[model samples]
Target: MSIKIRGSNAYGHSGWFTVYCRICNRKLKIGTDLVYKCPKCEKKYNAYFCEADARGLKWKCPYCNTELVPVI
Candidate 1:
């Protein structure tokens, strides 16, 4: 997947934003929000996904079944 930087002044902060999921071409909304980064697939999500729900202790991506690395 590819990552892109999108910026806006909606939150009054100006900077580069890292966006994941190239296939989906998704853009992040401008605001204070939370995201869970998947290590293997390098995907981002809005909610907390448990390892069990993600299907293993390896912290894999729920969408691609690849191991996920948490970014906080």
Candidate 2:
């Protein structure tokens, strides 16, 4: 599954996506930050994680109990 962008309607920005780490509350920017995305829960939960947090969780989604995939 693809990472769904939430609240995309901002001033002058059309297709920009702002994602955050689920565990650290850190802002994750595409092309700069390595993010783990929950394939099963992204649309519903908007679950994204930093590399360390994702590894800490054993590459699993804590909410949906599904395997987390890295966003490349």
Candidate 3:
């Protein structure tokens, strides 16, 4: 079964995406190439792309529980 993504984060083929907070409406900038930090809300999401990552890992928003899926 294919996982469904319901949040504002759109996954692309580039294998990179910026996480956004619906409450804060702010674009999260990638820092340190590891930790995903929300500048405005100061909330950290486990940034995961639904796109084709080598490991085929899955990710969801910690606060909202929105599934991240590929936009294809």
lDDT leader = 2
Candidate 1 all-Cα RMSD? 10.4
Candidate 1 lDDT (Cα, 0 to 1)? 0.44
Each prediction's TM-score against the native?
Answer: 0.30, 0.73, 0.22
Ranking according to TM-score, highest score first? 2, 1, 3
Please, what are the lDDT tens digits per residue for candidate 1 over residues 10-72?
444434454433334444432333334555445244433432443433555556666555445
Give the per-residue lDDT of model 3 (tens digit) for 1-72.
998764455454222545543334444434422323223223344343322331233344444545443322
TM-score of 3: 0.22
Residue 4 in model 2: lDDT: 54
Per-residue CA lDDT of candidate 2, range 1-72, in tens? 976545656454534656888888988876677889999888887889999999999998999888999787
Clashing pairs in 3: none
- Going through the candidates in the order shown, the clash numbers are 4, 0, 0
lDDT of the candidates, in the order given: 0.44, 0.83, 0.38
> What CA root-mean-square deviation does each model show from the true structure?
10.4, 8.5, 14.5
